[model samples]
Every structure is written in structure tokens, then in C-alpha cells.
Target: MRLFLCEKPSQARDIAKALGVRGKGEGCLTGAGVTVTWCIGHLLETAPPDAYDPRYKQWRLEHLPIVPEQWRMQVKPKTASQFKAVKRLLGQASEVVIATDADREGEMIARELLDHCRYRGPIQRLWLSALDDASIQKALAALRPGASTFSLYHCALGRSRADWLIGMNLSRLFTLLGQRSGYQGVLPVGRVQTPTLRLVVDRDRSIEAFQPVAWWGIDVKLEAARQVFIAQWQAPKAACDEEGRCLQQPIAEAAKAKMASAPSAQVTDVRTERMKETAPLPFDLGTLQQLCSRKFGLGAQETLDIAQALYETYKAITYPRSDCGYLPMSQHAEAPAVLAGLKRADPALVPLFDHINPGRRSRAWNDAKVSAHHGIIPTTVAPNLDKLPPRHRQVYTLIRARYLAQFLLEHSYDRTRATFECAGETLLATGKQVIEPGWKRALPEALAAQPGREPAQPLPPLARRDQCPVRDVQLKNNWTQPPKPFTEGDLISAMKNVARLVEDPKLKQKLKETTGIGTEATRAGIIQGLLDRGYLTKAGKALAATPAGCSLVDAVPRAITDPGTTAIWEQALDMVQSGEMPLEEFLARQSAWMSKLVERCKGLNVTIEGQAKAPAWKKKRKPAGARRAPAGKGRKRTAPAE
Candidate 1:
């Protein structure tokens, strides 16, 4: 008999239907000598330290670093019955098939059960990108040998064990030390959570310590041929800051005085250049989460949940947890079918039918760039939008728009910069005129605003050496504003772009190209865990570190809270996946490093600072139209864009 092990019941059911399996068994579906069983996530979990030796549960400092000689995994109490069913099938089956999500975690999910149940048989792997019948049939036609992906399992196992060692040892070590200092609350540390918490703590400290500096500027209104435009006065280098904000009030006053007296401004130079902007590639999970947070104020985990439903429940999209945004070249052939299905599902999309070209291929399709799975996109058969929930429909639209953008033309425009001179002071005017709104038309109304600089008002036609009559001149006082608190979207972007914070060039580039401290599938969970543990709090849309969270950063070694170090470990895990390093060697190095870090901090005095209160996000939002008046009115100038 052939046994198929799947990651979840929904996944198993989908596959069973595709394969014509109709008979149902206890915790499984069976037909025609083929049996399919599902796991509710992982059926077994790593045994805790106490499971190794009951004495370790008491939490004595003497048992500080609980290192197990022979690691053990026991069946979880909640899923033990399913485990038993799988065990029975594994014992009787002539061959086994791993039909799980196509990722490292899924590999571990199936591999761990095989190891635990002591199943030794010929194994084949099924890599499915979507639960839709068409996709399922495609995947079934190309079954890969189990060994082709076996390394992913070891890589995932290494990460799991490393996290266990770090979390189990360090959390106990700090909690005991905190107890010694009279703080009763348990201090939880993690491989990724600690660094994420530190990001908020560091940002809060910077905002608190920032000092605002007053600056000066002058805006002049000039008119030529009845067209008026604003020109900014630029101060001389000696009296200006690095960003050219006039630092000395006297200097700005002097320039404004001369410009006000002048009757006309001379245009020294006029330059215009054509520019084109390509549409962004479809989103990976990280980018999708960020956009959802920014546009809809959805939490990271909430976005992930909706995307997962779209992939599994509705069969409306491909995998939602993919790390790659580039599409596989093989998928481009299905574009016409996907487009037709989309139009059929939603009447609102009918007008765009003529504009979309299925033959046009964008830069997003590249076989070499795809890894395991391609971008999350609409499946060939689009589900009925009327039946889908509102949130699901909105998210689906966002994903669909990105894919549709690939078939549209590039957005093109003409950028113009005009330099002016007035009474020994330099003045500049910039503007842009849109020639075409290409891919932007594909965006839904809610996402049509786009993310970038505010479009400049188009300047009236001008030539070199033209004199424009000055209408008005005003000198302005502005203060430099501190960095704004991070929204969930901002935080997600920071976590993914953490490479900018690292000083090393090689590691910096590698991490920036790959991923940051966490995988696309786990970053949301890490953030949600931090919130549940009270290490972080949410105010409106902003994230702030709690008192306990701040104290934890100080108590632990800096390396533990460093995003760079954590990202390095993520890269090492990649090495394990590529078979560049043996799993045992990777774990050995991790164990040695963890043991040393634990030893160094064993004797430190620890005092955890505050009690954890309920997270602020759960509270009702205040009514709109409430605004606190500022002390005085002054235009604020922001820092230049990086």
C-alpha cells in the first residue's frame, strides 16, 4: 500500500479529490490501495528539558545549560490519536509520499514523523504551489525523489534545535537571575523576538533623545506668461547645514530682504529629461504584509491569515508563504486563462479586459530567480468574489493588481528643473509632467495613490535667460522634526531591510539580497509573540517597547539583541540547506556558541523592570476630529530623502 502524508486536513482533502480517493478511514482517506493521512501541523514536538531528566523542570541554576545528549521528540497530547494512525500506516505501507507545503518547515513536518515512527521505505516528494485541481495535477505529473529535498529537512531541524537550545537555556538563566533580584515575572528571550524588540526600544530611545533645531527658508512666487510657480531660496554654503537648510537666521533674513526688493528673477538654466518607471514585481509575503499594514491598517499576522485562506480555503491564489516575488517562466503560459477567470469572477474588471495583453511578459518572469515556489498570484480558476469575505476580497484584489501590472506599459514622464538667480542668492524650481499612466491604471482605487514623493506641480513652459516678474516673497521659520514612530508597515520594512544597519559589506549585501532576521513564514509570528509576551505595545498604529522590554535589552548580552548577528545565523541556516555545511557540524557550532554565551552571563545581576499590562491595540480607538493645538504655528521642514 502507498501512504501519503500531508501537512493539514484541507491539503489532504484537496489532493485526495484530485487523485480519485473516495474512501474515508480514521484520520485518513483511502481508495484503490492508496491511503492519505494528514497532520494538524506537526504531530510531534521536541521534548522539553524536563522530559530528558525530570530534575531539570525544577529550574535550578545548577542545571543552567540543559544540553541533551540524545535528543527526543514525543507525540503531542492533542494529536496523539492522529499520530497513532500515521504510525500504523507507516508500519504497513510499502512506500510513503510526503505531500506537504513546499518549504523548509513542511519538509521538517513530514521528516520528523518518519523519524519518530521509525518508518524506513522508498519516499517520493510532491511539491504543490496551489490546491487548485489544475495545479495539483501539474505537481503530480512531476514527482521528485525524496532525497532531492532531504537536505531542507536537516536544515530546518538545525534551526529548530538551535532555537530550542537558545530559548530554553537563556530564558531559564535570566528568569532565575531575575528572581534573585526580586523581580517575579518570567523574562522570555528568543532567537528572533529579542532582536525585534530591541529595534523598537532603540527607536524609542532615539526619538526621546532627539533635539530639534530651528532653520530658515524663503519661498518666492514668480509669474511668467500668467503662470505662477514657487521657487525656493538656497543659502550660501558657509551659513547652511549639510542638507543646505540655512542654520543662521541672519543669513536667511539677508537673502529674503534682497529677493523681496528685486522686481524680476533671472532664469539661469532650464533642463528637462524624460524618465520611465517600471512597475514593481509582485510581492513576496514580507512585502505583502507591509502593504496590507500600510493601506488597510491590518496587523501582520492578520494579513498572513487572510492570505493563507486565499491560498488554501478558496484556492484563489498560489502559495502565500513564498519568499520569492519572481514568477517561474513556466507559469506565463497560463496568463490568458487566469485573466479570463478573473474577469468572469468580477464584473468590475471587465473594462480592463481590452487593455491587458496576455502575450506581454514583464521582468517578473525569470526561471533562475524562482526558488521552490513563485510569487503569490491568482490561480487559473478565480473564485467568486461575491462569496468571499470582504477582507479576503480586498487582499485578493491587491495581489491580483500586482500580477496584472506586469502586462501594462511602463509609466513615463518628463522631469524639469529650472535654476534661477536673484540678488546674489541661488533659487531652484522643479516639476514633472506625466506623459502616461501605464501600469498605475491596473491598481485598484484604494491602492492608486502609490508610494513615493508627492508629484510636483508642472511648471509653465520656460526658456533660458527668461525674466519672470516676482509676485511675492516670504521668509519662513521651520524646525527639524524627529523621526516618526514606526507603524507596523514601517517595522516590517525595517526588519527586511536590516542589512542597512550592518557595517560589514559582504554580510550586509548577502542578507539584503536574501532575507533579514526571520523567514517570510515566521516574522509575523515572532512579532505577535512579542506582543503577547508584553515585550512590545501598540499605540494606534505605532509600536513601542514596554519597560520590561527595555530592561531585557540591557540584561542580555548585546549580541543576543543584535539584528546583524541573528541575520548571520539565518544565512548559516541557508548554508545548511545548500549542503555547504553538515547538519551535525552546524548544530555543534551552535551548541558551542550558546554554551559560551550562557556561561558568560550566568553570574550577571539581573533586574526585570516592570509588570506587563494588556496590549494597547485591544482598546477602542479615540473618535476622529480631535486635534491638540500646537504651541505656535511654524512650517516644518523634513529631512531629505535618503
Candidate 2:
């Protein structure tokens, strides 16, 4: 009998349906010589330190760096029944198929089980991105040889082991160190979560240290041929700051007075240019999370959940964990069916039918840019919008709109910039007029362009050197605002674009090419981990680092907190995936790195100045008149410091 292994129960059901498997069995679906089984995420996780040696169970400074000579995997007690059922099935199978999620983590889920069960049989791979019946059927007809993606297991194993070395060694090291500093909270750290925590800590520090700067500006309302418009006074370079904000209050006041006294101004230049803006690419998980956070005030994880429901539960969309916003060129052949289904999914999209031409293609359809999974899009299966929950409907609508946008014309507009000279002051006014609504027609008002800033109004027609009467002049005072605190959405975007945070050009390019810190599938969980550990707290939509969180970043070594370390790891993992670097080499380097961190930080004396006192464990106090060695080494040392 042939057996198919899947990542989740929902996924197993979808694949079983495609294979005409209707009989339900004890932990799987079975029919006519085929049995489908699934894993609830990973049935096996990397064994904790204590699993190797009972002595390691107690957290001690001496047990600082626990690098395992031989890694072990244990079946999770919560899902042990499912593992047994899978093992029994593997024992009876003549051939096996790995039908898990189409990514590195997904590969680990199935391969780990295969290794544990000691199954040796001919294997095939089912690379699926959508849960709809048609998509499942298509994937079944084009199965790949298991060898094509065999290296992916090594890459995932390398990543899992690397995370283990960092998380186990570093977390214990820092937590133990914190205990010495009178901090009782456990400082849990991970390869991705640490750098993510540092991002928030650094942002919080910047905000705490920010000092607002006061500035001034002048606005004049002018009337030309019974048409009125507003223009702002342009500050000279010497009187302005680097960002072009006027810094001289006196100069701004003089300009306001001079402009108020002037009766008329002559327009020096009126340049009007037409521009075309291509439709935005379809939704990648990161961009979708960012938009949902901004528009609907949804958390990153919440957005991912809604998207997952749309993909798996309702079959209204394709895969949600995609990092690429570009679609495969071959998939473009199904656009007509998808469009027809989209129109039937929601009645609101009916009016957009005329605007959407199935033949027209946008830049989103690119073969080379497509990743493991294409962008999130509507499937050919029509969904009943009324059957979906309110949030599901909202997310599905957004996904549908992006798909509809690909078939519409480009958004076109004419931009006008008018410059005027009045009472020795230079003033400028700008306006935009849309020539074609085009793809924008498919989007709701909330998803419209420039949703945050005030929209530009239509400008009155004026010729070059035309005279206009000054109606009124107003002096406006402005303050240079500090950066806004990070929202959950903002943190998601920051994680994906961490290259911008690095100062080194080579590292920046590497991060950019590798698609930033965490994978699209894991960033949401990373942020949630920080929140769960009390390292971060959410205020309204903004994420703020707590004292424990900030202190953890301060206490941790620079190598662990810096994003560059993770970027380098990602590069190595990529090399492993491509078979350029061996998994053994990657694991060896990570183990060496972990040992060095423990050695360097084991002897240091560190303390967080303000916090409740922890349990006494060799507390030491300085003598009143003792001379300090240096400011850096002046801290009173405490025994049992990690």
C-alpha cells in the first residue's frame, strides 16, 4: 500500500480527497490501497539539555555550555498517539510520499518521522501551495523525486541544531547571570528572538532619549481668478535643517510679515507632468501583515491566522506563508478561472468585472521572482463570503483585490508643482489629479494610496508668471517629532528588512539578498515569544520593551544580539540548501561559537541597578571607603554569576 504523510490534519484531508480516499481511520484517512497520515506540526522537537544528562536538569553556571555530542529527538507526549499510528503505518507501507508543507521546516517534520520509524522505501515529494481540490489534483499528477529536496532536510537540521546551541547555552547563561544581578525573571533567548528583542530595546532607548526640536513655517492662501489654493514658504538652505525644516524662527517670522504685506505674487514656474504607477504586487505574508496591521489594527499573528483560515479552511486563497509577491508565469494560465471564482465569491467585486481583462498581465507574473510558493491569491474555488467570519471576509477581500488588480490598467495621474515669488519669499504648491482609477477601483477606500497623509486637492489652472492676490498669511510652529514606537506590524516589517539596521555594506547586501532576519513563516511567532516572556508589552498598537527586556539586551553579548550574526547564519543555511556547505561544517561552527560565548561571558560581573532583590546566593557588598579599580570594572562581584 502507498502512504502519504502530511504536516497537519487539514492538509492530510485535502490530499486524501484528491486521491479519492474516503474511508476514515484511527489517525488518518484511508481508501483503496492508500493511507494518509499527518503530524500536528512537528511530532518531535530537539531534546532539551536535561534529556541528554540528568545532571544538566539543574541550571548551573558550570553547566554553562551544553553542546551535545550526539543530538536526540523525543516524541512529544501530547502527540505520542499520532506518532505511534504513523509508525505502525510506516511499517506496512510499500512506498511512501512526503506531502508536508513546502518549506524547510515542513521538510523537517516528515523526514524526522521517517528517520525515527526506520522506514526505508522508495519516496516521492508532493509540493503543494494551495488546498483547493484542483490544486491538489494538479500537484498529485506532477510528483517530484524525493532526492530533489533531500538536501533541504540537512539545511533544516542545521538550523534546528544551531538554534538549539544558541537557545540552550545563551538562555541559561543569561538567566543565571540575571539571578546574580537581583533579577528573578528568566531571560529566555533564541537565535531569532534575541535580535528581534534587541530591535525593540534599541527603539525604546531611542524614544526615551529623544528631545523634540521646535521649528517654524509660513503658509499663504492665494486667490487666482476666483480659485483659491494654499502655498508654503520655502526656507533657504542656510536657514533650514538637514531634512529641510526651517530652523530659524526669526527668518520665518520675517517671511510671514513680508508675505502678509504683499498684495500679489508672480508664479515663476508651473510644471505639470503625467506619471503612471503600476499596480502593487500581490500579497506576501510580510506585506499582508503590515497592511492588515495598519488598516484593520490586527496583530501580525492574528493576520496570519486569518490568512491561514482563508487558505486551509475555506479554500478561498492560496498559501499564506509565502515570502514572494510574484506569481509563476505558468500559473497565469489559470487567471481566468480564478477571476470568475473571485467575482462569485463576493458581490461587491461584480462592478469590477468590466475593468478586469483576463488577458492583461501585470508585473506580478514573473517566473524568476517566484519563490517556493507564489503570492497569496484567490483559488479557482469560489467561496461563499457570507459563510466566512467577518475577519475572514476582510482578508479574503484584500487577497481578491490584489488578484483583480493584475488584470486592470495602471493608475495614472498628472502631478503639478507650482513655484511663486512674493515679497522676496519663495513659495511652492503641489497637486495631483488622477487620470485613471484603473486598478485602484478594485480596492476599498481603506487600501487607497496615501491613507495616512492628507490627500492632495485639485489645483486651479495657472500659467507661468501668472499673478495671484494673497488672501491671508499664517505662521505655523512645528516640532521635529521622534520616531514612532513600533507596532506589531512595524516589527514584522523590521524583521524582514533588518538589512537597513546594519551599517556594514557587505552584511547589508547579504541580508537583503537573503530576505532579512526571520523567515515569513516564523516572524509572527518570534514576536509572540517576546510578548509571552514579558520581554515586550503591547500598548494600543505599539510594542514597548519592558525593563527585564531592556536589561536582557544590555546583559547579553553583542554577537548574540546583533542581526549580522543571524544574516551570516542564513547565508550558511542557504549554502547548505544548495549543497555548497556541508551540514557537519555548519553545526561545528555553531557549536564552536556557542562554546566561545559561554567562556567569554562566564566570569563577568553584571547587574541591573534598579530591580527587586533576588534570592541571596553569595551576595557581596563593597566596603565604604574601598578604592575602585576602573568605572568599567567597579561593579561589586557576586559569586554564582554566569
Best by TM-score: 2
TM-score of each: 0.93, 0.94
Model 2 C-alpha lDDT per residue in residues 4-38, reported as the tens digit of each score? 99999999999998898999998989999999999
RMSD of 1: 8.2
Where in model 2 is the C-alpha error above 4 Å?
608-642
Candidate 1 lDDT tens digits, 27-118: 89999999999988878877777788878757777886777788898887988999999999999889998998899889998999999888
RMSD of each: 8.2, 6.9
Candidate 2 weakest lDDT stretch, 10 residues: 630-639
Shift in Å, residue 511, candidate 1: 2.1
RMSD of 2: 6.9
